[model samples]
Target chain A: MDLQLIDQFAKNIIFEAGRRIRTAFTYDLVVETKSNANDLVTNIDRETELFLIEKIKSFDSTHKIIGEEGMGEKVDSLEGVVWIIDPIDGTMNFVKQHRHFMISIGIFVDGIGKLGYIFDVMREDLFYAIEGVGAWYNDSPLRKLQPVKIEEAVIGINASWVAPNRHIHHEKVIELVRKVRGTRSYGSAAMEIAFVVSGKLDAYVSMRLSPWDIGGGTIIAKEVGAIATNLRGEGFDFFHQDTFIIANPSIHQELLEKYIVQYD
Target chain B: MDLQLIDQFAKNIIFEAGRRIRTAFTYDLVVETKSNANDLVTNIDRETELFLIEKIKSFDSTHKIIGEEGMGEKVDSLEGVVWIIDPIDGTMNFVKQHRHFMISIGIFVDGIGKLGYIFDVMREDLFYAIEGVGAWYNDSPLRKLQPVKIEEAVIGINASWVAPNRHIHHEKVIELVRKVRGTRSYGSAAMEIAFVVSGKLDAYVSMRLSPWDIGGGTIIAKEVGAIATNLRGEGFDFFHQDTFIIANPSIHQELLEKYIVQYD
Candidate 1:
């Protein structure tokens, strides 16, 4: 397969999908409840995902899909080329904040992320990356990431992790929070992962994440010399729900071993 | 006093300051530490603040100033007109993330926030409010805020508050965290407050904040029918450090009474 051809194809479809979202921005969206009343899904998410899935299938009929809103082909394994898409990451931010959200899509072949694209619809910024080729922020190639220590790093973590929760120990998370320079949570896991690749944030950690959330970002992170792994410092399964910790190469091992330990 | 003339003057100066920041974006910035090595201060912050101060002084030398970087005149009282400026409210965000930060300036007369201006430098979006003329985003006048319930509302808060801490009761904060529809922490107090006025975020809470950190946002919040008060639901003193909870009219009182009671 010509890698450049795949990259160009992925970029075009992603931008087309973004245009669909942009057009639907002016419409009155019907927001329905997903997990709960608070967890929201607007009509835009469904329509955008459908647009992407249709376009991807036309481009390569054999490819599989894993989509956030469940509008794509289901696969039990990442045996073939799979497109993981979150039509609109940071849905809460899109609904409430009306900004700071993006559309993320990842092209992976046999469980390996090949291309990642995150489009900030409102701002018209497209952050794209091809494996082995560098990441780009609106056409400017991203610089190779410099390794930084945890104490000097700015991390992205939801307040839920530090708050009393079932997934992880709050006290250990607090210790990590205090040790970091500062913390930020943008309400979008995809954007946070993109930030890690761009070197804007040194790391991003979360207790709960789906394959559609980090699949694209994992490819982008690796291109910029970052690491995407589980809390246990193991390879993440691209077809299942799991805990994610994506960080700069310098601190990736240190974080997994020292900061995040499995607690029953 | 010509409020219209002052508004125009403030707006022009702010836009100019923003332009100066944009010009420096492509250059290699000389970054230095302020309070500690971890606390970053970019040359852009100092340059922008200096530009605003000089412009404001050229416009009116008699106004006292209280600036975050200590470059402006020391403000003892709110007698006469006092300008509280945080050239870049989220300096860390500016230094690290390069987005999600704002240039905030609040004009107070006799200790009352008379006018507020928050310019999102990167996005070229401006949010401003006069004492009674109502608030605006860019040239369009913002609508009066709609009522939001806690369970239906999205909140902006510092992730630190959710973690175990000494200043505020973390457990109670966790209850608030879980009770809200969703929570986000963007790392900029002024911008967070601007979101409150824009009806994007239903509320914002911070434990340790200085006057300049939130001065501009309070005025904008007030003009949009939101309430800005201390955690105890009392009048806020704009010159001293305090715990702020700005929110929609419906939930402001309930949040304060239920979760944020201050006791000796």
Candidate 2:
């Protein structure tokens, strides 16, 4: 497979999606609640997803797509070429702040991760990876992530994960928050993961995230020698929602063992 | 006082300081640990502060200055025309990420906030206010902030406030975190307050912050109908470090009464 070509194609599609998103922001958005009030879906999100799916289909009809807005095919397994798309990863941020949101696309072949692209629509920062070739932030190639001790690390984690919530023990997470150099919550999974890859943030932890949320970021982070896993320190499932902990290789295990507590 | 002219003058100084900061990022930095390992100060921070102080002193010799880097006069009170300066608000962010840090300058007349300026140096976005004339984000005028309920508000709060630490009760803060729509920690009080003023964030709560951190933001937020007070719902002390809660008027009292637990 021509990974470079595929990467370029993905970047073009993402940039196009970003343009559409930018245009949509100027006009009044027709927003609707999805699942819950906090889980919002704007007209722009659907439109961007449809546009991406159409581009993907025209590029390769045989490729399967799993999109956040349900505009693509429902694949049972990653058998052939699979594309995971999150039109707007931080839909709430998009609707509320009109910034900090992203369009993420992850491409896989026969269950093997290949190319990925994450575009910060407003910032116009394009983060992409071509399997083994390496990840690039805009025009420059990203360096491998450096190891960081827990005390010296700045982790990206929302307060939700550390509060008395259903997913993890709030107290243990609090301990982790205290131990780290600092904590930041941008309310966007893909962007936070991109920060980790770019060395802006040392780690990102969340109690629940969808495959589309982590798909693109996972590939980009892996290219820079970062690790992505569930709270249990296991590999992510490409078809289900799971807790995510993407961090530098040096502290990933330590964070999981010390902070992340999963109740069976 | 000519608030508008002072606003413009402050803006120019901030922009110039921003330019210096940007140029400094290109060269190797001389970083020194301050109070602790996490408390950092860079040569750039001190240099930027000195530059701003020179400009302020030259612009108006009669003006009193209070600066984070200790470059300005040590005024015992907010008398006369006072200028509170944080040359680089998010010093750690500047040292680590090279973005998100800002230059914040707050001007006052006889202890009353008269004008303010906060510039995101790397992004080149300026957020400033001219007393009665209202706040401007870049060249665009900012609208008055709309009210948001606790359940629908995105609050800017660091994880330290909710963890087992000094200042506030961790349990109550955790409850507030659970109830709010979401929480974000950007690690810069000025930027967070700017977010609150711009309606990107509904409120910002910090257990400890100095005058330089909140001075400029207070002026801007107040113009947007947001309220700035201590966690105890009292006014801020311009001469000392204190807990702060800057928020929309509608939710300010409620958040203070319910969430912010001041440990006597």
Judge candidate 1 at residue A258 and give its lDDT: 67
lDDT digits (tens) for residues A57-123 of candidate 2: 9998998999998888778999899999999999888888888999988998998889888889999
lDDT of 2 at A180: 83
- For candidate 1, give the docking quality class from DockQ: medium
Write model 1 residue lDDT over B108-153, tens digit each, in one string: 8888888999999999999999988789999889888998778787
User: Candidate 1 chain B: minimum summed lDDT over ten consecutive residues — where?
Assistant: B255-264
RMSD of each: 1.7, 1.2
Model 2 misplaced regions, further than 4 Å = none
- Local accuracy of candidate 1 as per-residue lDDT tens digits, A29-129: 78888988866899988988888888888988998888999987667887788888898998988887777888888887887778888888888888888
Could you give the CAPRI-style class of model 2? medium
TM-score for each candidate, following the candidate numbering: 0.96, 0.98
* TM-score computed on alpha carbons, candidate 1: 0.96
Share of the reference A-B contacts seen in candidate 1: 0.71
